[model samples]
Target: MQRIRAFRARSTPDRPAPLRRAAAPAVAALALLLPATLSGCAAFGGERSGIVVTTNILGDITRSVVGDEADVTVLMQPNANPHSFGVSAQQAAELEEAELLVYNGLGLEEGVLRNVEAAEQAGTPSLEVAAGIDPLDFAEGESAGQPDPHFWTDPVRTGEAVDLIADAIVEQVGGIDEDRVRASADEYRGEVEALHAEAEERFAALPEERRKLVTDHHVFGYLADRYGFEVIGAVVPSGTTLASPSSADLKSLSDAVRDAGVPAVFADSAQPDRLTRVMAEEADLEIEVVPLFTESLTGEDGDAPTYLDMARYNTGAIADALAE
Candidate 1:
């Protein structure tokens, strides 16, 4: 439920290309190209509405659309690293009952891929949100445009994802309140659009040179694409947070950060800051860890409990911090 309050991404007049200094670092550049892990199933919220999402990010949005109509049992648990997630027997059993299974396709949930494959065999319909969004092409020799599944990083794209995902849910799941669900989706979509507009307005005010983003990984590709920002590189040099980073990748990213004159490195607040800290410490640069929302959403008590809330919180954070 943690919310990002420091960083804002907005479209601007001048956009700069990423600095191409060296060949691909030795890290598994292809790994970051892969999507997150997946889950088998679960006894979610003590009631089974037959709708289950693979990740908390999708589950949160689904809950908003389904409301009391369905009880969403999220497969992945809180604080459980989804990149290297493991499924359980109970979770596997839940998939058998799912009429609609929502997930971010495009190789996210790699570990969960096997489970999703199994779920498909069990006759459960899996919906990948990244199915329609414009994808990013990987660097030459990187994982060939496998299409990053982290579209939720960009609020506009996430809004699009929600609209599409909600429709699939209504059409696939039986007895859902169509008027309620569609209206909820439209209302949420309007909020997301507003958040994007506000972010653009706020972030566009930053100095041109400050439009660079350095992070633990290239998760912000969608955000950078939505607004005008250059992704300098990442500490992991891969896609999923489940992978490990090498000392060489650290030095390289730190060098890139200093070279790019970026004031900060973006990190996910939902996860610990050990790696960003290490990267900052090693880089010996004035790097601030701009904690943000990624992968999972917050609970009802959390700051970003829903997709729209996450976008608004992140937009405000990025706008305020970058404007500084």
Candidate 2:
């Protein structure tokens, strides 16, 4: 039996007090130069009047579909864990005022879900990208039977999301060229579809017995379902990274890993690889811990700055690791 972290919260980086102090004088000076409302907005996160997306991956897709049609504001920073990232007061205000609020629904953005709900209540034209696509539930985990919100793992579904987001932008956002939006979406969708084909070809070369995955968590279910891979186990046997694994969970996963003989355990790049390393040792087998950009995108300098890049990178990494 696996024990789950019912109330665990993932730790996030905190700003130093010295930095805050340094910024205070600049903020005060800027406040004096701006109007009261705008000053308040600047204090939080700057007001965004255009499309506001919760996750960076969805933000990238939205930007592709929008293509200079409108301003797109992404709340989640690069390489930040979606399960634990939060919004500032001004960003929350911006969500309510957004022309279109795009988010990954079905509980992926655990920290800002209430803000999304509030934005919905405030009548912000919203689109839940994950739910629109056919979402799958956890087959086995503490979150079993709940809809998996990581549908973006499957490029096919992400292509579908492009269409949905484009349609919403055309219907909801005011003063935008619908034709341009549609055209941009079509172009981006083609790229995403191409990514799916690339992934299929890349993964097809692996032997059937090697098409098994053990990960930091149950984040690759959609990818596994799409690519015919089996997710034998995960270090954290839950859908969200916020959940922690107990001694029984580690032992159970290690036992499964030993039995399955998978060559690698994939950990999210946004997360620390400590637990994954521990699990590998517990397996008592020489297993490699491969870091994958599973939950978030990285900065421009990083390997996975875009959705297409992220998928391609993960596909190659998994294939290479398993082949060895």
Candidate 3:
């Protein structure tokens, strides 16, 4: 895990108190310019607003729970990979002004953690939806040892995240009528459970020959564990984009793919599939490259744009490809 220092919005950069003595007059004047009320956090936008989420996945879940009752803004956007993000001054201001904040945890948002700390210091209450779900062990060998943060690969765990999200929203918003939030979250949870049951039935129908999964990245450990799929290998041998696979690692992955007779490698729609294509070609086998909505949902108009919609869409895709 990357270590990040804490920050307070608008606070002077830390320096020795000796230098501070010379600047006491300026510091006192600066303090009085922005009154305490403006410096501290209070009800955002109005006395009674709803939520502001930090990641795209948490943002979607928050929408499901808040419905139309609360205004929402996702700090990260679709097609933006969290691994390569850096926060700006404007966004820090946004966090300071927000009512409530939510983020996906388990070290998934390492790049944005500094900004998150800043938000917390500014008194914006933030909740991590992936708080209680079991994260997958990194199974792509020793070098792939980062903790797997992709819990939503399994619907059961995703349902757990949704439950936490509902609780946080209700906690933050006081009594803004949780009936809609509760009903919606419960309804979605039921759908996820039903989807899992259906996927089990379909996987059971497949001949054992087609139960192996290959992928461009070391994603889907949760899905494999939940549904009895054998995870043969991946082109990039790490649990996250921050790491790269070695030449020997690639050779080993190719050998494993060939030995297992795996037909295709699946990649996330939000990610490019070039590495999967290269792996397929090097393996000298007819490996299909398929994309699915795994990391982030599609744009609102596109298919699988919502969390509930992605649950149904991914279920159909996996069943279609893996079922015998």
Candidate 4:
């Protein structure tokens, strides 16, 4: 189990200096000071139960592996942008009380990262899922050279994540049936492997030219790599949706769209489609804007309630849109 000093301002060697410095001093300081106090309090320690996951995607995966064995709490809500979603005070306190902390730690959760660090400072065992998997760097755009955090787009990589979570639960989380957790992971892994095979066949049916992808942001690097598609460009030109595209960036992307003759541009379902629509309109060509569940999952009544459902839905949506 990975452990850190109890409530100290520790350096994050994996992240850039700018991102490391982005941690709110006030929040970090409070977290640093309160872990001891939080731990010393009988109520806080007594309430520490189950696993706490950062993103809904990982939370769903964790639930699949954990089943009814342990209580799993997900911080990010349905249809919420992972880059901007935040936790409330009660939720923040729960971070310190988590039996294990799991997060997609390639800077995906910009809003809740400090809270994750706070939990780590409080001596909670953590699994940075993306770091454990072999991550690919953003090939181009504003976040070029940085590790791409959107690994969930690839089902094979997602299977690896399931294994990691199961291993963490058995090792870090106490009083759980390790055998049952392992069995659940194996079952889920089989499902993900099937999804990978399905995606391969689905993408293979498309013409080479149709395999090119344009999106609202630089989110499909892993998917493109996995399925042998080219990423033409993104409207935002950055990894996170929080970043805006300059006029020059928009014009450049629009020109690329026109040059490539891409018929459709995919936008995240959680975010507005205005930028994609603008890029499509500016291209002076017939371009369709398709919505995809790229970053977050949805409610039970929605299209993408689970990770598997999200992947299948996206695979079909991309195939159908590009094929047209």
- Model 2 lDDT per residue over 84-171, tens place: 9999999999987887788887788999988976775554556777766777888888988778889988999999899888877876
TM-score of every prediction relative to native: 0.79, 0.85, 0.80, 0.88
Residue pairs in candidate 2 whose N, alpha carbon or C atoms collide under 3 angstroms: none
What does candidate 4 score on TM?
A: 0.88
Q: Which residue window of length 10 is worst by lDDT in model 3?
A: 14-23
Q: RMSD to the native, candidate 1?
A: 12.5
lDDT per residue as tens, model 4, 51-85? 88999999999999999999999999999999999
State the C-alpha lDDT per candidate.
Answer: 0.67, 0.81, 0.67, 0.83
Runs off by more than 4 Å, candidate 1: 1-49, 138-144
* Candidate closest to the true structure, highest lDDT: 4
- Model 2 scores a TM of 0.85
**C-alpha lDDT of candidate 4 relative to the true structure:** 0.83
True lDDT of residue 111, candidate 4: 97
Query: Model 3, 159-249: lDDT tens per residue?
Result: 8877877766666665467888899889878877887787677777868788898876777888889888898977777666666778787
lDDT of 4 at 231: 98
Order of quality (lDDT): 4, 2, 3, 1
Task: Please report how far candidate 1 places residue 42 from its true position, in Å.
Answer: 20
| Alpha-carbon runs more than 4 Å astray in model 4 | 1-47
